[model samples]
Target chain A: MNTTSWLNPLAALVLSPLLPGIINRTKAFFAGRRGQPLLQGYYDIAKLLHKGAVYSRTTSWIFRAGPVVGLAAVLMALVLLPLGGSAAPLNFTGDIILLAYLLGLMRFFTVIAALDTGSAFEGMGASREVQFSVLTEPALLLSLAAMGKAGQIGSGSRIEHLDNFLSLSGIYSNLSASVWMRNGTILLLVAGALLIVLLAESPRIPVDDPNTHLELTMIHEVMVLDHGGPDFAMILYGAALKLWVFSALLAGVLIPVRSAYWWLDAGAVIGGIFLLAVVIGVIESSMARLRLLRVPQLLTGAGVLSILAFALILWR
Target chain B: MTGLTGSDVQGHLAVAVSPLRSVVLISGILLVLIALLAVMRSRLLAGRKVELSGTWDCGYARPTARMQYTASSFAQPLTNMFGVLLQTHRSLERPEGFFPTQAGLHTETGDIFRRNVYRPIFQSVERLLLWLHWLQQGRVQIYILYIAVTMLILLIWNL
Candidate 1:
């Protein structure tokens, strides 16, 4: 109803691709090569929209439904998110669980879609996706839940964990440097855990190699290999949107850009998202993906960090 | 039901369950469906054709399922990470030299708990049954000797 609520989807549509562009540019800088234009994702999506899709002979409606369901789920998730430091278009006492499961819903459809193709590679990727997400999901929710606890900065009677009341606005609405200072260790740990979740959840390096063409090593890419034209485009845009959600969450926490005027805070939050993109690019450039076997250890370590963060908050 | 306490404010911190806007979700789904229909309609209007073919494989004259990595091979690293419990069995036949006859690899990653726990229990039960078979001799003399021994023990006790 309000201008800020209207801005959530508006910003998502126009600005989601920019984060990936920033990341690509940052990676290009580290590699000493000029990357594609920042608008490449937009161009790819447009091209995909114009082209005809190719469905395999063995495929069914499930494959076709994958992108549609996925994009829809992510769209719903965007509604719950308090992007650009504004209250979500949709918010409630416990909206964080809904947001997390919305993404989970996206993943569910994706894996089923991949399975529908009857491709061994897609099945393998689906398995890996599920395995890695098992750890990342807990880390993500727990860290966000920890931030929810931090939201009680000036409140009486604290609720804890995702099972309690991890609201989108509840976490980001009142973030400030003072909040960070009071629970600096807690915030720092949660952020560290969240950074890992962001990387893993978005299929960034260390959990998956987004740039790799080899099927054996693919996780997210291989699952959608059969999709072409508009279908593929939907997947690409959906992924960009998913990345945007994770970035918003991570940036919202790390940037704590609070201003009386809504637009200024929104601008600062957008800037923070781009900055997070650069950080991701730097990380990709600086490290090769972990050995596939060791990925679980890293994810489990993230889980441990979140648990430690949770323990610290409970002790307080 | 639990709550957080603060200097100036008083309220529950985390909501027990996340409240979502079903209307927003329904609208989002509707939009996605419309977009998909539009895509389908455009494809029909444009009459663009699709060519079906095998995925491009490395230029082998003939591509077989064996040439591509199996799911197990693709996930070998992760499986090996938990080799302690997974206990994957591998069988391979390597070519001896440049002019090879045949080479093959088979891998089986079985349920560790079933193998380590259930199999052992069943095996021990089998062994116990085998040991218990000594008492089931079918001869009549064995049965009579058992009864005589019982009667002599009873007579000695009575004296």
Candidate 2:
């Protein structure tokens, strides 16, 4: 458990930037173009950190606190998450709920900061972000609940108990009924929902275009328009950390190889992370940014699918 | 004790009826007074005859309501921009060329909260709970009829 706990944050920090890089590389490979270095994001963050930050005259203290709080929240959630089926350092009842709420808190502050700029473009982005999250939240929780229930895990249990592959396999094997069948179905459903959520939340392609300079069509990027220097670095790192944590969680649920061997589990987790990034890159490279009006339909479809998962669990 | 109980029931009934009876009586008297005053004022005005003359059109004989700006026209541009989210429906009819027989336009926008948020959720829930739809149809009417029947039963028992 301690080995897993130590490895989780270390892995999150090391692999966070690489995930985006890998996605871009995958997309580039598909297009038959030379891809950027895997460490390109690291270089970008270093450049941003060295540069001086420009403060917006229209902004208040919240703009300053937004990145700090955002980074802190994601780090805290990573601490709560188990890497390769190991319990996190801080495990408590309802910790997963706390993790989700902490992420929500970060988003709440970030959105407020966006609005504080008094930019109509930022305000529009914030409005759409909040509106979409309202629908996304239920799907997220419902899917998690379905997975937990299918595994015969109690809702109030700490996430730490499910950290590594060994424990997951132990729990999976010891169940009186067939847990893997239900777990596999729930995993697929959750993975699908989380895939969409990752795209939306991370401001990836289809839901948002990170590379786009136009603020009007931007989601996450537009919200951070006024941020610079260390603040911008923090936002970038925080987003990467968030993507890493969610991907790790999805990997834990889907991957079956869990033993006392930390190296194997870590490799599986990293491989899962890479696979997720490739999928994201493929999605971004292939799909055009959805019409703003149609984005809600995509989110609603995710919500409907998650609800069906919940209903299936209840019915069974 | 029995005699006192009978008087108490009568007293309670009076307590309920007295305020309503007084309110009706006072309003009836006020209505009559208002009618009488109106009749007296008209008669007094009729007795005094005065004649005055001025330009009926206030020196602008070409004035028309068509020349005035309307509130809807002022808000047309903004409403058009957000038409999708606002669910604004518009219909316009115009005659070709310079001379037009009739030209009219109408616009109606749905409630923002209902169209964007509430209706979608409601539809989702309805789809999830299709069996419960019958229970909600004419629900308010059924509730009112149920209340009326209960009141009638109470009234008969009291009588």
Candidate 3:
């Protein structure tokens, strides 16, 4: 509600592209090669925006609508997020559910658009996408629910009057060092679940290989193979923003720096996010992508962790 | 459309409606506007060198719709997951020998409820109804005798 709350979405819009750049640089560092510039993501988007698009004859308006609608959904998710040490610009009880479903909406459009292409490769990608999301979504929601429960415990009687006490802003803002100290195990479990969800949702290593050339092996990237020019730019930027959004959620839990100064809180959260991205980069460098059959098991493991966390909170 | 106007309803209504007002509506408008922006940006910056071509199929000069992913293939993963419940029957004939003659894979998924539940019940109903087939006999005398017997029974009961 405060004027400073605008900083969260603004920061996300401006700096999201950097997270991917940082991750790429980290991977390059591990590979013993000088990486592209940190602003490479921005450059790609700019170049893409400067080019013309080619539409498949098989595609309809849904193909065109995918990137724009997806970007919009991510933007909506970003606005609902509480970052730095403040509430989100738009926060209400049950906004957590909205945040999750907004991502779902984005994915729905992307899948349908891929299907609209009527390409076998894109269809393969879409199948893998929906298949993985079947596991990923439950993990995400359960993890968020766990965090909400932990937040409820932290806020105690204050949120009792509300119909649903699990707003993203409320949960993030309620997270503090003391709460972490008290519920360290639950938070740890939830954080692990969230990290897996982040990697899976963002199409990172282990769950998927973003750089895979074989369409049979790829998931997210293959879905957009037919998109080019400004549409591709939107997709790319939307992806970066999604990674940023998930990173922010994870960082919020990992770094509970709730300070009086908004700048300090924002700085810590953003720093935590960059660190998480570096972690992801290092992970990609060290680990091979999981076998397609194994991805579901990994996602199911995350769900188990979240379920465990929720159980811990419930019984406690 | 009905409106909630009273002050008592305002607080709860506003709280519930804010997400629709702020997130959903804004996102919808933004989707259209940004899509238009993308179109215009591409137009302005592309400098009119746009090209249309077939989707890259690994440079196979000739590609047909038959080779494209079918709806069934698209749903293959999900169907495979629920195969036991769906009862998707599949048959594969792999080509043999140096010069392969024929290869085909056919999959059929039928309605589980109809196959497992409804069909048996309907079959039993048909068999039970078949027992009454002898009543029709294809004869006018049989119908007259049946009517006379019904009339005699009715008179006896009345007496």
Candidate 4:
């Protein structure tokens, strides 16, 4: 647990920015172009932090406080999540619900702050973000529930607790049996749902285009248009941390390797992060962002997939 | 008048003493008392006015209600998009072509919850339960038949 405490924040601080860089590099390499350095994001963040921010004339205190709350909420989620095969720092009976709600709180504030700028472009982006989120959240929760049920902690166990040693071993043991085909099926379905959620949550392709300059279609980027300097850096770091946390969760479910050696789990966790980044990069390179009208359909498809997984679990 | 026998008087009293009759009588009295109170209170307060004549030094001026904004203008854009759902209506008088005169526009939107959502859902439920409507057709003969059937079933089971 003490190791988990030290490693949780350390991993978030050290590896958060690298995930985005890896994704970009993977995409560049796949496209046959020389990629940016792994440390490029770190340097960019440092430069941003050294500069000053310019406030928008139309914004209120919410605009200034938005990034701060966003960063804090993401960090809090990190503390609630287990880095590898270790328990989180703050484990409670129902911590996973709190974890998801904290992220929701961050999203709510971020959207409101965007709207406070009174820019129609930002408002449009905010509206789309909220609509997509409303469809995406159920998938996230249901998928996590399926994964939890497969581990035999189905009744009321928090998702964050699934990272513990006993729970990890239980999940692996159940997967090895033919009688638990339902469990395996649900696990695979959840992985698929989570893959979609990863795209939706991080503003990746097929849901949002982070690299797009067109203000009318941008979701996450348009919301941060008025932010600069340290505030912008905070937003970037917060997004990176969220990506790392989610990827780590996906890794915890997919990777069944258990070891008493902390370094081994840490290595697996890092490898999982790298693998997720590559997967995301491949997806972005392969597909275009969904049309604005069709994005809802994609999100709803994810929700239905998760519900199917849940129904399979219940049937079993 | 002939003196009533003790047995006849007891049978009449038993018929009059019923829980349902008491409940109906009490509720009827309470309803009348509430209506009377409401009428008397309104009459007593109708002519009363609060004097604000010297409270302000501003010159006397009567205030009109036209300064307020109407709900229609506030919800114009929303009403336009969902006019079918809301059952909105509009009436307008426009100026004549080439030579303009007085012009005005009026619009109103109905609540979709009543017209579209609730009424349709309820109608579908009613259709589904159409058979149950025959059970309560407001016919005395049908009600008497139902009661007779119920009592006969009870008697057969007891036997």
Candidate 5:
């Protein structure tokens, strides 16, 4: 590991909550209203942290465990990801699978916690969350695998084993502007699939509205309705971090700025992440959420995109 | 196996199991503890006004355990997706007239392998084994005659 490998994680911990703020501000600009401050996400978490929590009578230790586990899992995932042109803090062979399953662990805890509440709304939300994730996870893994293969091809090293390509840092560090120039089509397809995965995995406007009020219509939001105070703050912060993690992965692909200067690469990746947030905000402002039944089709479309990208890579 | 060092295999195995022993696991526990402390601090800030009440059930007056989501209901979405393979049998009886009858829906998921494969094989095996039942007779004289016939055959062979 490099001396400054820890800088990326530090940046993520400090700047992740800013993503929701930026996204909300962009949405407000589109709506022609004076929006909340750019630091509104931070303010909300702080306010929640200062208040008392209310636990449901039906809930148990699992409910309390959800937010903590989710936060920790996302934190772990944040480390596994390589931001900008820098390698991740922790990387080994097959770390990509670990990254994917870390997110899975977060979701599993969230789902079981929701189920523990015994509320019909939470159960419904949990079921929907699981159903959608079924499609998103495959797209996520396949896209990463395709990108790894692409990176392997681009590097053109004769001595290194193929297993080295399976790590996030290995693949991402190898990727540069030239790689994209050579394999633009496959990367484009993978990028599109990953963007869809990001939208679906995070509670964005198209998949599940973060600002939704009706519990019956909610998916991710409904699962955490019973939590309050610091617990809710952990969840909110965890969500922002989750969004950051996905954005980092997508940004790495979208902007393969492998400059000689470390600062330039890092700055470009961070800027790319913020740009993605703005784009997502604009998408939220312009588009409406899909009907509940049609969400599976959208997710499956992402899966198909990933499979096509992988197949194209294999063909070459 | 011939050239690779033990450290190399250990490294590979370590990578495989690293997710479980990650620093995040320890940090996750610490995070939970911190959250607990924060909750306690918040409680102190609130001056003990955190009220305990029943869950909101859309003003249904009194909510019972039956109104809650069951395990089957929780997995309904996934089950619906794999319905063809599961072949879950559902029986629904709707109330014929308003305020007059009972209505119920029952769903049963049986083990398909036992139904289609194991029972038939076990039944055929039982049938094939029934022919061996004729070896035992009720009388002691019949058993003695069999022993004597075996002895006579052995004596003639010796001669």
Candidate 6:
């Protein structure tokens, strides 16, 4: 039993909320203002938990179930992902596909909850979220596939082990110093695509401004406008975890720092995650959100990058 | 033949499969966590009285739903960018004079292909059918004359 593999999810649970706090702090520093405490998200979640939930008369159980199912689905996905160099605690050959679709299931529930409110703003947010996610999902999966091809060139030919094509470990399992030197372009393109996917999926600046209060321009925020109290806490925590998962995936790809010492590798992966949050914070501080029409263009550009990466890997 | 991600077996048909024991363990932990949160929330809310009130309007007494942005208006920028393709049809009742009553606007984003493509084809077909209405005229005399002409042509051909 690979007992140490459990550290991935435990670390993810304990440290995920710190990510948004760091991003907020970085943004505040750039703006020359004292930010909220680094534990502000944790405080907010605690406060929200103590409050009473207010449900709309128009909503049913599905509205209440949205946060529950979304958080659960994301947790399920976390078990499939390998945050460190080792395999996920629940790793399987095709766990990668399960991870991708589990996220889609989460989005599905969120959209359904938005429509349940029957509010114009929530509906609009739902429409935009689904449409943008349609583009981002392909970019994400294709980029992962391209990166997985890097792992295929281990001790043997990839053609021999074709059945293991969908394993998430295939993205990083066989990363050697020589592989990166030989196929650096493919790695670069895949990283670019994954970066776009991370930003779009996590409601980062270029795709969405999570701090925006203008309902007309909101995407993920407006959808949850009506959810209050404990339900809202669940949603907030779920968002942080979602951000953590994407950040972890991107960091694992960018920083392929594997070691025989499991603790050292886990420490590096965690450090890489925090570094990614700082990079995201700098990016948000630097750029404005894209115009709504321009969003599809950016997503399509990511898709093009993924395709290029895939083609490069296939050629070799 | 192997599946897209390949099969777990050498010759059998099962796809790439793994029993997610970790997921089962995680799910149990998560369920317990959720239950704890629910209990904590209930404990906090127990016997706590709350009141519902109208939304604060920031000193505006005439607070109304109309003040909020409508669905179409909220998505105006996106719809406008795709307006040529979406073919959004809007009917506006512009406010006439000062303080005009009954001023309103309606926007319909119907299918572009149905409105622009099918409508013209359907209208032309209806026009052609109207023109062909003369063939089934309800006059016996004209019908007899048409039959006579047909009989004469056949008789002449036979000769």
Expressed as tens digits, the lDDT of each residue in B1-159 for candidate 5 is 479799988977876676556555545654675576556555654664565565655567877788788777776777777788888888989888769568888888778888889999998898888876676677899999989999999999999
Candidate 3's C-alpha runs over 4 A off are B1-47, B97-101, B111-159
TM-score leader? 5
**Regions of model 1 farther than 4 Å from truth:** A153-164, B1-46, B55-159
Candidate 3 lDDT over residue span A97-172, tens digit each: 7888889999999999998887778888898899888888888888888887787787675757453356788777
How do the residues B96-156 of candidate 3 rate in per-residue lDDT, one tens digit apiece?
A: 9999989999999999899989999999999998998888888999999999999999999
Candidate 1 CA-lDDT value: 0.79
Ranking by lDDT: 3, 5, 1, 6, 4, 2
Off by over 4 Å in 2: A153-178, B1-159
Question: Which wins on DockQ, candidate 3 or candidate 4?
Answer: 3
User: By TM-score, is 3 or 4 better?
Assistant: 3
Identify the superior model by DockQ, candidate 5 or candidate 6. Answer: 5
Write model 6 residue lDDT over A70-133, tens digit each, in one string: 8777877777778666777776665666788879978998988887776667777888897788
| Better DockQ candidate (1, 3) | 3
lDDT of 5 by residue, A1-316 (tens): 8866787778888998899999989999999988999999899999988887777788888887888778777877887888776788887777888889889989998999998887888888998999999989999999999998888888787326645578898888878888898899999999999999999998897899999899999999999988888778988988999998999899999999987898889889889999999999999999999999888889899999999999999999
TM-score (chain B only), all candidates = 0.49, 0.35, 0.63, 0.37, 0.59, 0.47
| Range of the 10 consecutive residues with the lowest summed lDDT in candidate 2 chain A | A164-173
Measured with C-alpha atoms, the lDDT of residue B5 in candidate 1 is 52
Model 4 CAPRI rating: incorrect
* Model 2 C-alpha lDDT per residue in residues A1-316, reported as the tens digit of each score: 4665678778888879888888889889988999999898899888876665566566777776777767766766676666554556555434556667768977987888877665555666677777677767787777666666555542324435432112222232222223455445655776688777777777787888888877778788878887776678878888888888777766666664566676776677778887888888888888799988788789878888788777776676
Q: How many backbone clashes does candidate 2 have?
A: 8
Candidate order, DockQ descending:
3, 5, 1, 6, 4, 2
Model 3 alpha-carbon miss at residue A248, Å: 0.5
Whichever of 3 and 6 has more TM-score, that candidate is 3
